[model samples]
Target: MPSAEAPAAAAMDGEQRLHPWSWLFVLLQQLRQFVLPLVALLVFGGGGGREAQWQALAAAIAMVVLVAVSLLQFFTYRYRVGADGVTIRSGWLQRNLREIPFNRIHNVTLHQSLLHRVFGVAEVRLESAGGNKPEAQMRVLGLAAAQALEDVIRHGGSDRAGRTPDAAEPADVPLLALDTADVLRLGFISNRGMIVVAVAFSALWQIFPERVASRWVEQHAQQLLGYATSMHLGVLSTVAAVGSLITFGLLLTRVLSMLLALTQFHGFRLHEQPQRLTVERGLLARLRTSVSRRRIQSWTLQEGWLQRCLRRRNLRIDTAVAETGNRSDARALKELAPIATPDACDALIQHLLPHAQWPMPAWSPLSASMRWRLLLPTVLVLLVLSVPAWLQAGPWGLCIWLWLPWAIYGAWQQTRRAGYAVDTALVAVRGGWWARYWRFAEIDKLQALRLSHSPLDRRCGTASLWLDTAGASNMQPPLRIRFMPEVQAQALYRQLSAALAARRLRW
Candidate 1:
């Protein structure tokens, strides 16, 4: 129970083993990965009487085997904290040693669940650029030891620096803090609850017996119909009932989303240190992570219609932290600002990228004929869709043509709002109509620039410019400017290429 400094100092010398209880955590981690299969086994494999008892015993044996394996791992895993980096050696039958340099580490994450906190232990993960998995994962370390290790890595642990692990450093500058209100706004703006529901439904479909599920649904449907018949309900009453049910479902999802937000960002705080940025959050499970400021590769400012109406926006960044096999890595590294006012978001940008000039005055519009170019595709799609509707409904199907006006409006609005901005330090593209976003990157971060013209674009005398950055997320919109005049697109591409050539890529 010593301070973080004590463990850090201790770790700096010879090789060290994990906390004694590390196996417990390792067991739990393994269980989590196979939880579904285990549950299915318990429910389906276990028959009544002796069969159930035998199945239960088998499951217990499996758990005991897992525990034994975890213990073996704990006994085998050893790490050494040196001046330059940490060397991890692990294996039972076959020995494996990995040396992770501090300078190459892109992300240092510490996680503590409720149980881990009770045990005064934490899990540590180290990630580097372009790696498919975490460079190192320490299952259980003393809370202090984990922080000390994180601090050492953050401060550059090379031997030549001759730096003390516990040396006092610059105070963390407050960047952004989320209050209950901010979390609520984020919950309302996000569709996480719906996603959770969909996932739950999918899981049930996979795990639940189809006959049982169908029987339950049939019983409920029959009861509802009987009740309606007894009440002599008309179409209006049925419609009202359905409307109420839909409203309730929506409310339930929103409430779930809010609860999720509360747990995830209960005490979310982003802070800036001398060399890196740090974030700490969560209610039941605490997460603390840091990424070097220079490691950020691209920035995104997003505002859906809901966010816009709520007067909030989400600011995200792509970091050099590689996309890892761990799903949680994406959630941890992507969000820079989950929810904030426009002005606050801009302030954060200004503080982080002082050279780039946070708020570019005005974005240059795309080609004047961009609307026509956009509309052409919409017209073709609608024409195809209208045929189906007309075939089905005959005269009534012609009403599908009415959708053209909305499509036209959408195309025009998108063209009007979509544009690109360039300055000495940054290149940004703005796009989307209802769900708008701005993607920008420092000129130096440009990995590649492509200027290409489609057949349609060529006929329209326009081109598209694609910008690529390291570690960019495919889920997010790309930094691409479409329907720009061919000459301007080519010029911008050349300018960005020159910028990339002149600078050394930092990340």
Candidate 2:
């Protein structure tokens, strides 16, 4: 029988073929990509008749083709491990060859689903800087082989200090670890429950027949109306009943969110290595990924109202690796401390950026007119919307103006909370009232800087400054300071630009 390191040895000597079951994983992955359409077809394609027979025949043919393609790919794909790099060759007809140097690979990721674990196999992805896709991806390999490959690449494709690739080493220094209780806290503090609910609702809507949905709604509506008529419930009672139902729904969502957190973050741990940081997490589906210490481009500290109440905060990092377009892959690298105390967060930041002072003593406030500038858009929006409200509800519609006080209060809070801080080593922005964040990057890591003035800003004598960093996420707010004095904005931009020009980017 072949040993666990057999695959690694084979690759080092010549070329290696993936595990025998690689085709199954490839097939499952492809199927997952088109699951929604497949669900729709399965739900709606079974109407009886000659048309149904044709649909069934076509589906069978498609499945057979998918299976054949997966098999073909597994047979054709081949990779070799070399002293300086790795080489991959694939495609029987087209034929492609590629080589990736160990020094250029920025991210090394391993994923193991429950099935993969049961089969003692794992998936590996090697990502390079400034590419939209992974440099190389192996669908399935022996767990030991995967780790050995990671070790070889991390040590510049050579054994470390004359030891074998699979030799055990000193214990890793622990940076952070999450237990079940911490994961539960994170779930309660996250809004991922709502996202999960929305996705589940979409799936149900796609799968359920229109008639079934209509019937379910009709039955519930009739039942509610009959109960109300029979009880002759007062207005207050009706309101209480609706409120109770909403409360129950909210509790259910929280429970679901907790389950999600457990699945995604159970057994989470962060470890500090010689030149890289490693993250290991997940319950049934595991992930192990590493990023070089110097590859970190920026950092963010996020604290929501709930997190503050729980005395927890989230610390994330941005790296120079190109966007993978996979949320799971992004999460593997970004989440350094999913949930940690304020002190722990500070310690982590200090350890990573020892020169850049963590938790600067004071922050420079934005422009004096920042409050009104923020409120101007809200006022105009309310005014425009009130017209429709008046058209429909008469005097009651005018109550929409009641929202103005709340908007004004929010603007005031935002203005007070938002500020920027800078030093020779770092530039940072802090903002957001209810859900607050601190975003910062080293001076050398900044890619670009912009100073802009809107029409209103010009009239108000205010401007905004924006800083660009590598691998920024579209979902997160930019590192910006809005409604600052024009002079201050210009000075900050020039200072950062000068700093960027003077130092070389580490990543």
Candidate 3:
């Protein structure tokens, strides 16, 4: 077998070799220039009896013309690699030149489809730091060549060691690399995709009647019925079995869909460089993403039931700076690495913030009064459910009563999961129960800081501190550190305020 380093070396040598069909690929991408408007014209033109025939003929011609132009362009485009940077020069009528410096390059991702794999060619994506768009992608490179190019960009190309801009690499950095097992663990732990599929299923069911949908449902009902009957039995066995089977079938379908979606990142790996961290993964479409330590504004750790059982966690590092150039062109940069163990996550955090403090002073828990205050939502829900039950005069009243215990339990769990810790330099907020998350932010990143007390909170001797950060509105519990004893909340607010007030404080 070829050594791992062979791929990197081969890529460097292959960069100068251009694929004959590269230009055709470029043209295919730009074929929309003519085909789209032509499509519009054909659809709305010829308003008489000949309209249908004309539209059909026009559509066929348009498709052929588009394919022909795309093929032409794909064959013509080519690129070359040099000592300083990679250069791409293409375009038939309006030639273009793009040179990307090795030092500025942040990530090099390789994507291979079945077709590309057969041809031994892969798409190489180049992402640069400190750029508005951050990424430039091109196809036609051999697979080995693509991986080699990635290695050069990641390790800083051989010629770039002493002469490259920003050549000074940070020392003593910790890099975490995920194995195949970790990828599988992450696949099972992720439920976001499952949740999405479930919601979509629910929406479709609501929009269409069950009778109309039952045909498809019934077709697969036997498989579900078998699974349910194997696991459960009861007095109303047949009816209960049917209902349970349907529910399990829906859940099983969602889980399978989620697993399929996660397979995209099946072979994930994290490479920690001296100055940055790089994540590379994909099943069909590979992606390489890197983030500089200096640019990471905040870090969040999340764990759900499966993750907790597996002792794994997901890490999300948020950067204040946006890859704006790519945004205008509608490109997405990779973010979020799932299923890192707690120790691995902690190490990554420490690597990003070497000198920062750890496990800051745990804030005092919420007062007993505050715990009672958390029950208000459950009380309101119970009352709402009771009203309809009382009017119906049926077993519905008992059904409402059955839900109260679960509601109270959920409230208690939420209260237990909420807490905060503050140190001179950082603040950590913990939230969620089944899906627990820990968010860490430096004191300096606060856009706004406040100590707030609701009328009920004040009476209960509890308060909450809201710390807002730029570009973090998407975060859950956007306002962190909710529901604490008033004194503790006030003290934390004062400490954070003082840190912000002092110009000497650094993140």
Candidate 4:
């Protein structure tokens, strides 16, 4: 007697269920809390001591009691999906109810651990653009069910006519996904060496005093020669051996810490949806970040040494949002999550501004003056490095010699890749070597534009135009397009000013 549409709707509703794996997680948590304390107590208690045995038993019993209470509390927790929002009910002593509206949900991420994968289940994390933590999370759910929920929210659910919601109609935006090639490109261009150096330096700071003392003792050993002859050989040798062991331990710890941090962030993925970009990464404690399109202020493309070899580039997007806010401000908030890859970045921007033109122009090479201007920074850095080396190694200290060619090459490549093109509504700039980047911005969104000339640049008849946007307030020099003809720079500035002025009037 029921209609065909009615049965289909019922089937969709039936697919939504509580994740079965929640029970396993609760059980594991309870076991860890109860068992670990008992094991610790037994390990530390002295054998055949009546007082220690009694004390250990009392601690273990207390831990078990606390864990039992927690398990009871967890059993009462439950969640349900409804027409307007998701409802969560929990707490044994005081029942709590919370609702999360569909519109407020930024992105739903399905995470699968090895255990979950084997069991064919996944955890669902609901992220909001405004919140400091997950807006809502369900620990276990069927993979199909999770996907269905994501689809429903992404498409705004079903209509009264019983037709499934159209995913493309509301935003008509294209989703951007990065391939493996893009991920490799991002990893190569990233400052992996710099990250490792920073981690190693921080670790060294923690153990520096001990290291310095040991080094001083070793270097001044001849000063202690008089004392060493009278001291027991065994004691002196033991002290030397312990110092060596400590130094080795410190070095190993620093290396491991750096490796862990670097490897964790190696493979990154930036997935673009209609309204937001989701950044998922890390080998441990995987991070899922949602960045809304409306919050983005500006974008940049970068390419470095390794990226050039792979013919790839990195893209960074800057968003506008206050990093600190109130608790309620935690519920939904704006974020600036940078994504890598120029092509994917361009796709995202084009979705946001479909009318804009791209790949505008590839002009002549960098002028002689521009090349020299870029080289000046390399020269300054070399001078700074040389001062210390010269003081330590005298006139023969050529340790800094190794960096000169690399610095010069980097400067040359940077100048060569720096170029810009302007159309009626959009402006594009291309730069970087290992990871090539092409940044596009609407002329209307540009807050300010200026043509700048250094004494060196002026003498060579070259100019650079800097573009500022509402986003990326912290960026140095904001938006810079280096090495341009003076005439072209002035013309581009005029056109951008006019477009921005028109946008203001319309708004």
lDDT of each: 0.84, 0.84, 0.63, 0.58
User: Cα lDDT for residue 2, model 4?
Assistant: 7
Model 2, runs deviating above 4 Å: 1-11, 160-170, 327-331, 473-475
Per-residue CA lDDT of candidate 3, range 1-507, in tens? 011423344345433644555544445445645554554455445576787788778777877876776565555555666667777766677877788777656454555655565666666777654455544677566666666666566555663334453455445233666666676566555555566677878755654556756867886788877876787677698777668878897667656645664555666666666566766566665555555554455678888887888888878765544445332222223345566778877876676677677555475455555557777767777878788888887765757677767767776887777777777567788877767888888876666787888887877787878886654555564647877888877887887887788844322
Estimate the TM-score of every prediction: 0.93, 0.93, 0.67, 0.54
Model 4 alpha-carbon drift over 4 Å, by segment: 1-20, 26-99, 159-354, 362-374, 398-402, 442-507
lDDT of 2 by residue, 176-270 (tens): 99999999999998878989999887777767877887888799999988988899889999999889999999988999899999998999989
Residue-level lDDT for 460 in candidate 4: 60
Cα displacement (angstroms), candidate 2, residue 298, comes to 0.8
| Tens-digit per-residue lDDT, 1-507, candidate 1 | 221233356545788889999999899888998788777776766559998888778888989999999999999999888888989999999999999998899888888888998999989989888877889989999887787788778878733257564556668788999999889878877888999999998788667678877888899999988987899878998899889999999989998999999988888899887779888888888888888988999999999999989889999999876676566674456688999999999999998998888788778988658888888987788788888988899989878778788888988899889988888888888999999999999988878888888898888898988888888856479888888888888888887888888888766
Q: Rank the candidates by TM-score, best first.
A: 2, 1, 3, 4
Query: Superposing every Cα of model 2 onto the true structure, what RMSD results?
Result: 2.9
CA lDDT for candidate 1: 0.84
Point out where model 3 deviates above 4 Å.
1-55, 61-110, 114-174, 192-235, 243-262, 321-337, 360-363, 384-389, 392-401, 444-447, 450-463, 477-479, 485-490, 503-507
- Quote the lDDT for 159 in model 1: 30
For residue 292, model 2's alpha carbon misses the true position, in angstroms, by: 1.2
Candidate 1 residue 471 C-alpha distance from true site, Å: 0.4
